[model samples]
Target chain A: MWRDALLVGGKDLRIEARSRVALAQIAPFGMIVLVLFAFALGPDQSPLVHAAPGLFWVAVLFSTVLAVQRSVAVEAGDATRDGLRLAGLDPAGIFLGKAAAVGAQLLVLQAVLAAGVLLLFGARVVHPWLLLGTCLAGAVGLAASGTLYGALSAGVRLRETLLPFLLLPVVAPVLLAGTRLWQSSLAGGAPDAGASWMRLLLVFDAVYVALGVVVFGPLTEAA
Target chain B: MAPAAPVPAPALFLRGAVALSGRFPLLAGVDLEVAPGEVVLVEGPNGAGKTSLLRVCAGLVPLASGTVRVLGGDPADVRTGVRRRIGLLGHASHLYDDLTVAENLRFAVRAAGAPVDGIGPACERVGLVGRLLRTPAGKLSAGQRRRVALAALVARRPELWLLDEPHAGLDASARGVLGVLVAEAAAAGSTVVVASHEPELVAPLATRAVTVAGGRVVADRATPRPVSTAGTGVADVA
Candidate 1:
């Protein structure tokens, strides 16, 4: 099972690398998103920096979705799907492999976004460690929920449109907690406020991941 | 008592297998008994429940009512091993276009956890070894794609093969290859069921002919016309 996940995960990563969807767009998209936020924030240093966490969370959230959705879509072809069903690899393994691939892609994208945010938008990470932890937790929840949605939308006619609709609502809570954590991290690592949100994000990730283990199988096997 | 009929291994049995679509029973009271080492052909025209019937037998669609058994176990309760014993080749050929033939086979084998000696032999058998060695499936012609898809049978070694139009895109020679492989699989103690509208082709190969219309098995009699008795090929009715 681990072997299958590694193989499929490696295959997905290779596909993304070949496509360059990850490395190419992350910086530009993240920059565009942040620049838009900057424009909205009206170039005021205090306001821009103050809203930096909010803007950062929004960008990361949308980009995380993009990466995760693509990871699942790439593996959802008819032959591949039927083969996977017959292959005897646990469905949970496939989901995990996909989630892991998506998570990695999101991480790589976030790294690029981090540099772009710092350089172009003049955003500073006052709490590097805290910020990274919050983002990782958020990414896990996003990936976990995204895996279930990916499998659900696999063979549907209008899958791309359907994915976000199905996932966004369920992902709302995680994003909310993530946003709160980002706000705290932005407020110069405020000890009291940020800690609780960080804890919430962790719990969100853990719960969603365990839930994914139970639900992803039926979704994958569905038609 | 007469010695049990080589009883290869019951590939599929439906004790009143019923499938309902909306309010209608697409297939009801379908008692289909297929033994091991039999090439059972199902003949039906358009909208005659051929696809639905095959889907039910393949354990794809749930039975609205009735019981279905495959390989001596209830299909619904059967484990992955039982599901693995039933290889299904549908209308699309279900071959991954992006992956090469060998890679596709490897993926299928890995996913299925099926143990086979060598894919090299299967590739050679499907006559895809030369052009298909590293050919991306998307680049292959329809016939080549069909051949590659059909090659799954060799790798799966399934006890029951539910092939829906396995001969559509193939040329005469390719059809011959397919027929031979089907016969060979059945000869090796596998039960084969296929839904086809063309009778001439299947007539020379089928042991029993089962016809369905309006969602029920209307006729399921051993070809009083046997393929062997008629001195053609295997017992099959297309």
Candidate 2:
């Protein structure tokens, strides 16, 4: 399973490297999302600073959808999904590999957005560990759920619209926990207050990742 | 009563198999048995369920009802055991657009647990060498992409080959290479099932022709071609 996971993970990352869709398109889209939010909240730095944590997570959330969609699109045509099914790779491995790829991309995006929050919103991180932990846990939760929902809607014609609808609601917990945890990690915030939200984010990540590995085969086959 | 004489299990078997797509019956009922090393050609007009037949055999589509088996096991089984031994070249080339032709073939071979070293020779056999090998699949012409798929199939060397419209999108020379490949696979004891509308092209390679209509096998018969003519003519074309 691990071997197949590495095979599939490497394949996805290689495709990303060649195409640059994630780096070129999706990453820019994420930055634009952050820029747009800052504009909506206006030139007042105080409001922007208070809203930085939420806006940062909101950007990550939206990017997760696009990343998952891109991941699905890689196998969308040429019966590539059917080919993978026939290739005999373990479905669990395929799920983990895909989620890992998305996680990797999300991690990079988070770093960029983290800097964006620091620079644009003038927000300061009081507890670097808590901020990092929140982003990592939130990214995994979002990636796993996004991958699951992406596969569910993969066969549908309305997947473009359906994915966000199916995915956003399921990943709301990550967004909520992420926002709260980020808030607690910011300057003039209580670091100890984030423990519950951090645990919540971890639990969310574990549940979906486990569920994705168990059900991805049947889900994709049905799709 | 004396024990019944034992029979070798066919490489592929379908008994009263029925498959559906929504309200439409893609395969009303298909019963087919293909022994090892027999090249069976599935000939039919458009929308006659030929593609569905091949998909069903590959376990891409589940049978709504009836027993179906491939390679001595259920193709629908979740285990990769049966799927690993089967190779399918569907209408879609199944090549990742971003990856080069060589990368696609290598991935397929590795995924199928075949030796990756066969990729170089397989590419050469299909005439996919030099710039074409490094070209991304999305950049290749239809014929070139078909050659890539054929090369990937060759690299894997599956026990059962399910090809749909194998002759489409290929130049005469490339088609000739495909013909030789099919013949060689059969010669190597692999069971081949080809679904095609072009009967004349597949005539020399197939040992039998099975006509499909409305998702059922309407006709099945032998087409015994002289080995010397098929081999020599295809060789000359190649």
Candidate 3:
């Protein structure tokens, strides 16, 4: 299973390296979303600083949707999904590999957005460890849940609209917990609540990742 | 107690296979049996369930009610086990567009747990060499992409070959190469099932012909001459 995961993960990353869809398109789209949040908050730096954590999490959520879509689109071409099914790779390994790839892309996107929030919104991290932990936990939950929903919506003509509908609601816990944890990590924020929200994020990640590994094979069969 | 004498099961066995797509029946009560070392051709018009027949045999489609055993085990029950020994070249080439020809074949071979050393020879056999091997699949023409798919199959060397329209996009020379490859696979004891409209192209390599129409097997017959002799004029068998 580990060997198959490595092979599949390596294959997906290589495809991303050549295609540059995440680098050229999705990442920039994430930055644009951050800028748009600033526009909505107006010229007041105080409001932007106050809302930085929530806005950043929202932007990452949207980027997770796009990243998951891109991951599914890799298999949507021709009979590539069928080919993968026939390739005899372990389905759990495929799930983990895909989630890892999406998570990796999400981490990069979050870093860019983090820089944007720090520079543009004037928000400073009081506890950098808390901020990093929140981002890591949030990205894992988002990637795993997003991949499961992506597989559900795959092969559907309306997946473009269907994915966000199916995914956004399922990931609300990540968004809420992520926003809360990010809030506690920022300056002049509540530090005591950080540990609980981090726990919530971890729980969400474990549930979805486990569900995905067990169900992905049967889901692909139906898809 | 001594183990029972090993008996070779039919490479493929299907009886009363019924597959449905939505409300419509894609395969209605089709029964097929293919022995080891036999090359079978499936011929029919559009929407006649030829593809569905092959899909069922490959275990891509779940039989609504039937018994199917490919390599002596029901593919649905032992999916990865059955699939590992079956090479299916469907209508689509199934190549990753971003990956070059060599990368695609190498990935496929490795995924199938086959030796990657055969990739070089397989690519050469399919006429993908030098610059062609380095070119991304998305940049290759339709015929070239098909050749890449064939190369992956050759490198894997599966025990059972299920090909749907195997000659669709190939040029005359490539078509001849495919015919010879099919014959060679059969000679080496691999059972092959091909679905094609141009039966004449596959006629020389196919030892038997099966016709599908309205989701059922309407005709099954053996070619008059041996497949190894470059036989001709068996297209009308169906």
Provide TM-scores for the models: 0.87, 0.96, 0.95
Give the per-residue lDDT digits (tens) of candidate 2, residues A7-49. Answer: 8889999999998887798878888998999999999999998
RMSD of 2: 1.9
**How much lDDT does candidate 1 score?**
0.72
Worst 10 residues of 2 chain B by lDDT: B226-235
lDDT tens readout by residue for model 1, A1-223:
5776776776677567656777787557876898888887786687776666667667877786677667665666554565555544666777778788888877777777667666665666667777788778877888877877777777688888888888877777766776677666656757567777777777878887787777777766564
- In candidate 3 chain A, what residue range of length 10 has the lowest lDDT sum? A187-196
Pick by lDDT: which candidate is best?
2
**Real A-B contacts recovered, model 2:** 0.64
lDDT of 2 by residue, B29-107 (tens): 8999999988998999999999998888888899899989999988876584798899999888899999999889888
Query: lDDT (0-100) at residue A63 of candidate 1?
Result: 80
What are the chain A TM-scores for all the models, listed individually? 0.90, 0.97, 0.97
Candidate 2 backbone collisions, by pair:
none
By DockQ, is 1 or 2 better?
2
RMSD of 3: 3.3
Estimate every model's Cα lDDT from 0 to 1: 0.72, 0.88, 0.87
Compared with the true structure, what per-residue lDDT tens digits does model 3 show for residues B1-238? 9999986788999899999998899999999889898999999999999998888877778899988889887666434478778899988988999999999999999988889999998888778999999999999999999999999999999999999999889887777778778888998999999999998878778889999999988999997656662633222221
Give DockQ: model 3. 0.69
Candidate 2: residue B127 Cα off by (Å): 0.3
